[model samples]
Every structure is written in C-alpha cells, then in structure tokens.
Target: MAATIPIGPYHVALKEPIFLKLEVEGERIKDADIKLGYHHRGIEYLAMRRTYWQNIFLFERVCGICSDAHTTCYCQTVEDVAGVTPPERALFLRVLVAELERIHSHLLWLGVAMHIIGFDTLFMQIWRDREYVQDLLEIITGNRVNYAYNTIGGVRRDVDEKTIRLVKKYMDTIKNAFDKTVEAILQDPVIEARVKGVGVLTHEEAKRYGVVGPTARASRIASDIRKDDPYAAYDRLDWEMIVFDEGDVLAKTLVRVYEVYESIKMVNESLEKLPPGPIVTEVSRFPPGEAFGRVEAPRGELVYYIKSNGTNVPERVKVRTPSFMNIASVKPMLLEETIADAPLIFASVDPCVACTERVIIVDSRTNEKKIMTFNEFMIRYGRKRK
Candidate 1:
C-alpha cells in the first residue's frame, strides 16, 4: 500500500512561483494536486476596461516568454471583429516574427530543463547560445520579452535589407548551435537516462486530456493549430508537422529540438519568400461582435475568445492557454509514477504557469458564484480535466 505526500503550493526548486501539490506514495506519485491562481492577473476582466488598441499591448504582457503568441491571438480576434485581412507582406512578416519567438522560447526552455536536471554546464552553454536569438529579436523588435511588435491589422516594424541580412546570419548561427545541442542530448547517455521514457502519455490519453504542442505531438497527436487551423502566413507556408509516438520526456524534448530546426527553416523560407509591401495598416475603429482566435504557440494551441459590443473597448476577453489545457494531463500521468520522476513528467507538458490560462463565465438563472481549479472540478465531475 502507498501513503500520500504533498509537495507544493511552495517549493525551493521552482524559479516560477506557481503552487503545485504532489501526492506521493513512497517513491511513486499517487496523484498530483496543482494549486493555481497564484499568477492570475485577471487580464481578461481588465480587457473590458481598455480600448481595443490598448488591449493589444496589455494582452501581450500575459506571458513574457510567449508574448508574440498572445499578441497574435489578440490581433487576430480584433481583425476578425473588424473583418480585415492583413496584406501578404504583413502576414509574412508576422510569420517571421512568430517563428523567431518560437525558437527563442524553446531555447530558453531547453536551458531551463538542463538546469533542472543538474546539467549546469549544458544550461550555461544553451543560454549563452540563446543570446544570439535574443539579440536578433531585440534588433528587429526593439524590446526582447514583450515585443509590443504586433498591432491590429499588421506588424509595427518593417524589415529592411540590412536588417534582413543580419537576421539571416543570426538564424544560421543559432541553427548550427541547435543542431549541436540536439546531438549532445541524443548521444549522451546521461541525458538519455534523464529524459527517455521517464514519463509516458499514450496517444489516446493525450487526446483525452487535450494535450497540445510538443507534449501532444510526443504522444502522436497531430493537433498543431497552425496545421489544423491556418492563420496568417501559415496557410501559405510549406512545412510538415512533427509528431512522435513514444510520448515521454525525451520525446517532448526531441520535438522541441526538431522544432527549433523547423522554425529555422521557417525563418529562412520567410526571408526567401519575403513579399513586397508595407508592414502596417492603420485603422482607428473596429466593428464589434464575437470572434474566436487560435494560434500555434511555442507551447501549443492557444485559444482566445473575444466579445465586442460595437465599442472601442471589448466587452469580454477569454483565454484558454495551451499550458492550461496541457497541464490537465499531469494528474493522470503522475499516477503510479516514481516521485523523483514527477518533475520530468510535469516538464513534459511544457506549461508556463504564469501565462497559462484565464477564464470567466456567468449563469443566466441564479448568477451563482463559482471559482474552482479545473482539475478539482474534473475529478469531482468524474471526467479528466482539460
């Protein structure tokens, strides 16, 4: 028989401040109880207070790492409401920026994971190389973390020839670095032991739990928002979605590594196929209605629901982030797994707790109050949380 043990709501190992309660029975995890709301900013609620233009910048701050994804979703939602499509050049530029963000985010994650596994040497190496990507982003977007580079109809900055050549050189450098990093992870026995088959989620379980991004792809789930639901220049781009069936920590890491190469391809292709036109299109007012927007973030499919009432300000903004959805698979994955393996399992989801998810809903009849964690509600209702 196994006994229960609680792990977080607080832990020294985390740089991020989100609370997670791990239930372990001996060396194995009996269940996991995640404690959320620690990082909640109520950005969705605040969106109703800001004008559509202001909302773009505000929403971008939702997650510093995946800021580009947040901005894209918000921009698309407004574009959906205003019934506007960005020009071909603007769309291509958007894709370029978005892919650059992905490479940056994934490299950052790789370094963090390396640090987690006591691979400080690898950690320093990856982050040191990561600087190149960051510099490229800074040169193009001005700001590193929250680019504020995106607007309603199109991107704010234009790529000139000199800037284009610089970005191309940077891309080549990082691509080679990424290749070396992947080779190390694949060839090193220690890295293999730490990651491979440690936490496995079958494809069926992944779909049932609504896992997304590298996590779901590791389980052989072909659910990239870019592929399934095309937005921006994604429809015009040529790339194959990567997937794996092993569904382990190693698989997820492999997906990210491969994705870095893939994102490099996207950048090179985008620059090669760069269109001729202006990058930004100015628009003051947007007609209002409801629109759902989704984008394939570095992590997974991020969903945004926007409700407008014919005003400059939106009536409601709801976000169901990929981490929020992917995190749900943690409980089931942890069950019967070793305690030491818990962190590896959690990492498989690649969740950004700070920028993960936010939501609100009202009942028409009683208007009763309800605020509960998604996992708890799912356990109570006899369904897997997602």
Candidate 2:
C-alpha cells in the first residue's frame, strides 16, 4: 500500500500558508506537490482601477519583504514607457535603499532558518540586528517597510549629508555584526550537521528551470540581475557577486550571508559617491507601448511587464517574483530527504510568497478541493495525524 503524509496548507514550519502535499514512504519524501495562488490579492488586476502614482504604492504592498524590489521594478518600467531618466543621484539612492533592504531580508531569512532548526536564540539575535537596517531605511525614505521611495521618474526623497553620515555609521556597525553572525552560522557544529550536504541542487538543474537568486548562485549559476544588467547604481559601485559551487543548503545560506556584506559595501560606496540633484522627475504622460523591468530582489530577480495605452493608468501590469521561480525547485529537492530536513531545505530558497504578490491556486485530482488558513491547516493536520 502507498503511504502519504499531508503537510500544510498549514504547518508550524511554514511562516505563511502554503500547501505542500508530500508523498512519503519510510520517512523519505517520494513526492512534494505544491499548491500556490491561495493568497492572490489581484494587485495587478487593480492596475486598471487606479492611477500610475497610486499603483506604485499598491505594487509595493504585493510583497512586504520584497516591497522595495517591486517599487524598483515599477519605477524602471514607468521610466521606460515615459521616456524619462531619473537624476543620477536618484538612481544612486535607489541602489542604496535596495541594498539596505536586501540586508534586512537576508538577515530575516537567516533567522527563519535558525528558528526552523530549533535555534530561537540565533533567530532572535539576527532579527534584532536586522532592525538597524529598517531604522536606517526609515530615515532615508520616511517609512521602514513600504518606503514609497521609488516614484515614477525617480526616488521620492534625496539622501542628505546628515542622513548619509548616519547610514555610514550604521553600515560600519552593521557590517561588523553581520560578519560575526555569518562566522557563527558557518562555524556552528549543529548548523553543519543539519545543513551541510543536505538538499543539493546541481548547477545544470538550477539553470534549466531558470532559477534566480542565491538558490541558483549556490549551484554556481552566477546569475545576478544587478551585475548582468548594471541597473541603478550597481554599475558605479565597486563590488562582486558571491557564488558557490556546492548546490547545498549550506551553500545557499553562505551565499545569502556573504551577500549581506556585498550589499553593505555597495550601499556605502553609493553613499560616499552620491551625487546632488532632484530625486524625482515629473512624468505627466506615458507613450503607448510596452516596457519591461527587472530588479535583483532579496530572493532573486524580480521582473515587471507593463503595457501602456497612452494614459496615466497602465493597461496591463504583470510581475514575476523570484520566489515564484525558486519555489519550483523545492519539489525536486524534497525527493529522498527526511521530513525533519524539509523546513531547512524549504527555507534555503527563502520563498517569499508575499514577495510575488501572487494568488494561491489549489487543484486536486480527487473530488475534494478546499482552501484553509495557515491556522486552519495546522489544526486540521494535527487532528488528522492524531
């Protein structure tokens, strides 16, 4: 007889609601079937209902963790369709905010990973340190989470000398702490016991599925939208992309940990060389056409496709978040791995469902089709298992 283990629609390890139907035999994951599109907000569908300016903020809400990335992509797309270039200073500041956001994001991921491994102290410490970046961001953009920094033409606020100095000081302290955290993570025997050599993905397999971000980099794919396209201030900054040849959970963790340092370096460089000018350009009209933009978000490459019909509102707006692509690789990774390691491996990609600002879709082979909240999933699963 075939045996099955149903893992949430609600599970403790899941930070949010995601249904993974796992087919298990003798503690080995024979299959992992994913059910997404359950939390779709129809944000893209709302583009037709709002003005260009309003939609920027709306899009930012698509994924709270990856909000700045969405804003960056939205701004770039608007700039392209409007045929306007932001001030060089605006571009630099954009990079500054992006990198800072990235630091917090990766730190958050690290904490979550630690939490999954029953190390709550490390999780708490990582989040506590990450708050510094959020504070710095607030000073620059007026809000920590949804900065609304990226307007149509450029960013909304300019980084003043005082603000820049504050950021520099913050970065200095953050970098030291960041380094310590990474070292601790890499050196911890418990971490290696759980992560090292677990959940491996080959470079060829990663590339074939068009996996982006640290998940792909851990596999030695070395594809970063920031380096490849040189968007925003990346071209001006002096930094290098971090990649590893081992496609394991350890490699993914290390790739993200190192990226925190690279981001700090890139942000400090941008601030030191920050130019003077208007942060935003007034874009009153957009020519009818299609424009696409992609940004290197915390999770991976975030892409936006926009179609304008000679109006202040976009006719079509589509976003492909990195989490969407990275989530695909989970199924392959789960095969043959023990259930205990599932959480660690799942978190390795740092799947930010909210990052995609997508909806969840559940289709079943059997006649039973239902959607439940994360809480509901857990309650039902616990009851069923008992």
Candidate 3:
C-alpha cells in the first residue's frame, strides 16, 4: 500500500511557502506533486500601476537573493523600450555587483543545504565566509541586500578607486576562506555518502524539463545565459561556464562551488577593467512599445517584459523567474528517492517561492478578471474559526 506525505505549505526545511505532495510505498517516493501560489504579492500588477522609476524598487523586492538581477533586467527592459543604453562604465559596474551577489547567493544556498543535512558546523563556516561577500556588497552598493544601485539608464553610484581596492581586498579574503571550506566539504565522508547518488536527474530529463542555473549545469546541460547571450561586461570578461555530467546532488554541489570561484574571478576582472566616464545615461521620457530583458541571476535566467504606453507608467509588466521553471523539475527528481532525502533534494534546487508566486483570479462564466491584495483575498475567503 502507498501513502501520501506532505512537506511544507510551512516546514522548517522550506525557506518560503510551498506545498509538496509525495506518494510513497515503503520508504521510497513513488510520485511527487508541487503546489505554489502561497506567497503571491501581485508584483506584476503593482509594476503596471507604478511609474517606471518606481518599478525598479518594486521589482527589486521580487526576490531578496536576486534583487540586483531583478532591477538589472527591469532597467534593461525599460531602457530597451525607451531606446536608451547605459554608459560603458555602468555596464562593467553592473557586472561587478552582479557577480558579488552571485557569490553571496550561492554561499547562502550552500549553507542552508548543509544545515538541512544536519551538518551545522559546515553550515556555520560557509555562512561566516558569506558574510565577507555581504560586507563587500555593502561597501560597493551601499546596501547589502536591496542595493538600489541600478536605475533607468545606468547605475546610481560610481565605484571609486578606494572602493575598488576594498573589493579586491575582500575578494581575496573570501576566496581563501571559501577554498578551505570547499576542501572541508569535499573531504567529509558523511556528506559524500549522503549526497553522491541521491536525487538523480539525468541529462535527458534536465533538457526535457528545461531547468536552468547550477541545476541544469550539474546535469551536463551547458546552458548559461551569460555565455549564451552575452550582456553587461560578461562578453568582455574571460570566464568559463561550470558544467558537470553526474546530474546528482554531488554534481549540483560541485557546480555551485566551482561557480563561486568563477564569480569571484569575474568580479576581480570587472574591477581591473572598470573604465572611466559617466555612470548613467539620462532619459526623461519613455516611448510606446514593448521590450523584453533577461539576466543570469544567481538562481538562473530571470526574464522581464515591459510594455510602455508613451507615459511615465507601464501598460503591462510580466516576470518569469528561474524558480518558476526549476520547481516543476523537482517532481522528476523526487521520484524513487527516499522520504528521508526529500528535504535535501528539494533544497538542492534553492527554490525561492516568493519569486515564483503570482496570482490573477478570473471568473468562469463571465470571463471577468480581478487582481486582489493579500488582505482583501484573505478577508473574503478566510475560513471561519470556531
């Protein structure tokens, strides 16, 4: 006989709200179903209502880990619609901040994974190194999380020589600390036993499911948006896209670990190649048109679509985050894995439910559409408590 098991909607292993329904026979999972929409914030609708300038901040809140990527893509899309391009210096600066964020995001995910596997010591050590990257981000962008650095045409601030020097100093420290940590993790026999063959997603399944980022790379799908569609200073820099053929948890771990080194190198290169001149290109008006923009976020490809109506406000705004695509692939990964490994397998994808959530209600008979705030929906649909 098979039984259904539920993990999350709210669980310790989940970073945000998501529901997983697993059908298990004995200890092995037979099938898995994923449910989302618990964390919807109506971001797209809000973006349409706010001015183009305001949308930057709005979109930045899409995901705290990928905030800079969100603003970068949103600003780029708006610039595309308005027929404007940022300065050369600004492009390099974008790359610098983006790579730094990537390092921090990967470290954060790694630390969380370690904790899920009951390796608290490794988790603490990884997070301690991650703090150095956060300090570097704060030094460069002012704020650690939502940097608020990107604007319509270019970045809001310039990177001075002193700041550049600080970036170099911190990158060296972070790289040294990170290398030692990686050595410790790779040498740990327990970690090896736990993650080596668990949650396997083959190359064919990866391609068929259309996963991205380290998850896809770990499966030998060498698809990187930075290399595939060059943007910012990525084309100018020399960095290799990390790939692995195993398509297992260990492969995923190694892919991220190697990518952190790649991100560190990219940051240093961007700083050395940082050019002179203005950081922004001012645009006073936006023309009527639709444009799309994307970036290789820490998680994966983050896409933004903007439709401008010759006004300050946008006509429509749509976002397709990487988690939205990657979360579904978890179904295939969970199949045949033990229930004990479920959380680790799920965490391996680093799903950001907040980024993936969006809700738009439509009436069936009249085909009427409505968008409601969280409070409004909760008040109307709240189950009465006895």
What TM-score, over all chains together, does every model reach?
0.91, 0.92, 0.93
Off by over 4 Å in 3: 360-386
Which pairs clash inside model 2?
36-360, 36-361, 37-359, 37-360, 37-361, 38-360, 38-361, 39-360, 40-359
State the C-alpha lDDT per candidate: 0.82, 0.85, 0.91
Enumerate residue pairs that collide in model 3.
Answer: none
Candidate 1 TM-score over all chains jointly? 0.91
Better of 1 and 2 by lDDT: 2
The local distance difference test score of model 1 is 0.82
**Can you give the lDDT of residue 194 in candidate 3?**
90
Candidate 2, 220-284: lDDT as tens digits: 99899989987887888889999999999999988998899899998889988888877888888
- Candidate 3 C-alpha lDDT tens digits along 1-386: 99999998999999898999999999899999888878878787687678999888998899999899999999999999999999999999999999999999999999999999999998999999999988888988899899999999999989899998888999899999998999988999999999999999999999999999899999999989999988888999999999999999999999999999999999999989989999999999999999988899999998888888898999878899999889888988899999989999998888989988867677899999787664565467783111
Tens digit per residue, CA lDDT, model 1, 202-240: 888988988888888989988898899899888888888
Give per-model CA RMSD: 5.7, 7.2, 5.1
The global Cα lDDT (0 to 1) of model 3 is 0.91
